[model samples]
Target: MLKKSGLSFLWLSAVAFVIDLASKYLVVKNFQLYESINLLPVFNLTYVRNYGAAFSFLAEHSGWQKFFFIGLALVISGVLIFWLAKNPINKKLQNTAYALVIGGALGNMVDRSYHGFVVDFLDFYWDIYHYPVFNFADVFICIGAGLLIWDSFKNKETSE
Candidate 1:
């Protein structure tokens, strides 16, 4: 039987996965690669395929980066799942953090396995500066990471 925390984690992960996939589908079906539709002065819906990790790391490599990223994500996801399983029922925030990261990792893993790249659309920029284009998966992953950091601090304070 799934523990309360475990079930909650799974549910959050499922929701994140669905949203990520749906958004990616909408972007890919509507926009051509490298195309952009401006939504605000600093934001746009831009379709881009990243063959590497965050900030296009190792994108210049010939082809091995695909498998490397896939393997890395898979390992990280497995670890997240294990961590969530061990979490206590009352640790909602930590469970949520794990779930978000797991879901996001799986989402990008799907893209890397099928398309050899991850599809990114959300874009933010200033007049001459820009953030890396990313998708819902990346957003969730970042949020999860932030939560993890916050929880760590909270735990440390409580322990002292």
Candidate 2:
């Protein structure tokens, strides 16, 4: 049987997933494809779709990348769930990391299934340097990965 704290992680995942989906929905409803609405000197809301992995890797491939990413996200999400369920009680940082990753994966999975591409709108750039356009799901994943790394280091420190 799962512990009570385990459910909290799932709840966190649900919130992240909902927020990501809502953001994507608003972007799709309001912006045209490749439309840019300047939000600040270094930021903009530019709607675009990614049919590839991070930084648009393989985006130009002959359409096979879509299924590949979808499968990858699903498999990753499943592994996260398994890890979450098996986590030690009260392991807050580890749980949070899993929740964020699982939520992000499922959020993008929804996009991959419904639109055949991941919708991205948040854009940041300098005059001549532009970061890759990304969405909330990507944010969650990055943050989660960071936390996981932090957790590992903290655990190592405590054991040393």
Q: Which digits, one per residue and each the tens of the lDDT, describe model 2 over residues 37-154?
A: 9989999999999998899999999988888888898999888888877886589999999999999999998998999899999899999798999999999999999999999989
User: Model 1, stretches more than 4 Å misplaced?
Assistant: 1-7, 157-160
Off by over 4 Å in 2: 1-7, 157-160
**Residue pair clashes in candidate 1:** none
Root-mean-square deviation of Cα positions for candidate 2 versus the true structure, in angstroms: 1.9
Per-candidate TM equals 0.93, 0.93
lDDT by residue for model 1 over 38-147, one digit each (tens)?
99999999999999999999999999999998998899999988887788778888898999998899999898898899999989999989899999999999999999
Cα displacement (angstroms), candidate 2, residue 65, comes to 1.4
